[model samples]
Target: MNTFKDDTLGSIFFQVMRLHHIRSHTLMGMQKIHRGQPPILGLLWDKDGRTQKEISEELHLQPATVTVMLQRMEKSGLIERRSDSEDLRISRVYLTDKGKQIKDNVEEAIKRLEDECFDGFTIEEKLLLRRFFIHMRDNLLKVSEYKEI
Candidate 1:
């Protein structure tokens, strides 16, 4: 029984918080798109008319992953891909009427999730928390850059 208190407590707390945050947000988004909606709606919520490559970059996912998701979404009739008028090589993604119709529902779900996450915080406290997370993200980006070097 190696009961390392400090390290074990911090590690477990961080992992649990991360898992809960991801699970809550994912569930909220999925529920909003319930009843046969596309899986890509989660990504589309950020930028509706982005190309698959753009979506992949923004979401920090591989282009191939985005391509597969888009294909499935297209088959489900939740989105359509149109050839760029100026560049045939580029394809623009647009939400179908069905997709557009669910935007409000998705937005509401996100709001509800956010509210739940910040349930007891004041508005200023919530803003500060947001800033703290942004700083943490920036620090991670810096660490990644250092790794690349």
Candidate 2:
């Protein structure tokens, strides 16, 4: 029998499984938010009022994709877009009353999903894991920026 310590393939498979498990739970939690609402809610959670372009940049999504999502969200009464006071050419997105009402529910769902993800971790372990992930993200960002230059 192959020992785990000697199985690089098993380690890689375990990492993939962990990633997929987190992603699946996250998607399921997002699905609970009213249809056509996740991205708008996520943006609003970060900043209640922002331009569509700003949202796209913050979320690392394309402006065109954000526009289409916003249009759908607006049609569904989850968001409203108004001309920017300082820039008439720019449209700022804001959550509607209905959208605000669902914010708590969405937040709760996310919290639950996180709890599920970190079910067995100690508080210190969780903090350490978060630090490691953040460091990895920063390292990758540096690599990407270097490649762009």
Candidate 3:
């Protein structure tokens, strides 16, 4: 064994996040959606036809970034941007049929990943882990300007 057997909390947090990113990417690839699109897709699935500005605010992303992602997703046939008849300035995003099909696929993928990640973990351990993760998130939010939503 190496002298430095790294067991730091920050290291573990990074390892978990990295693993989740990898898994999410693989899952999205299988579903034929971009990695960044799931967050948007999930938002739309929960409430279809949200404007880019609303999405940017809800996801805490820049409007410019959301615009770029929406363009890519629209080209992929996953979403459509429509002009708001009442408010021409605001455009609402709607999911295509293909995008609707992807909802269940990604949900299953997430569940599969969760099961794999938490395999053999007891309920108590899982609860404790969730609490710790939330606490860490709260700490991060405090350091930044983001408030709990």
lDDT (CA) for every model shown? Answer: 0.69, 0.73, 0.88
lDDT of 2 by residue, 1-149 (tens): 43435558658657756675667566644654433356568778678879887887766777888888888788878889899898899888888888887777766666776776789999999999899878866878787843221
Off by over 4 Å in 2: 1-39, 146-149
For residue 111, what is the lDDT in candidate 2?
73
**Alpha carbon deviation, residue 56, candidate 2 (Å):** 1.9
Ranking by lDDT: 3, 2, 1
Q: What stretches of model 1 exceed 4 Å from their correct place?
A: 1-26, 29-49, 145-149
Where does candidate 3 clash, by residue pair?
none
Give lDDT tens digits, candidate 1, residues 42-78. Answer: 5666667677787776666678877877787788677
Please give the lDDT score at residue 21 for candidate 2: 65
What is the alpha-carbon lDDT of model 1 when measured against the actual structure? 0.69
CA RMSD, predictions in order: 5.0, 5.1, 2.3
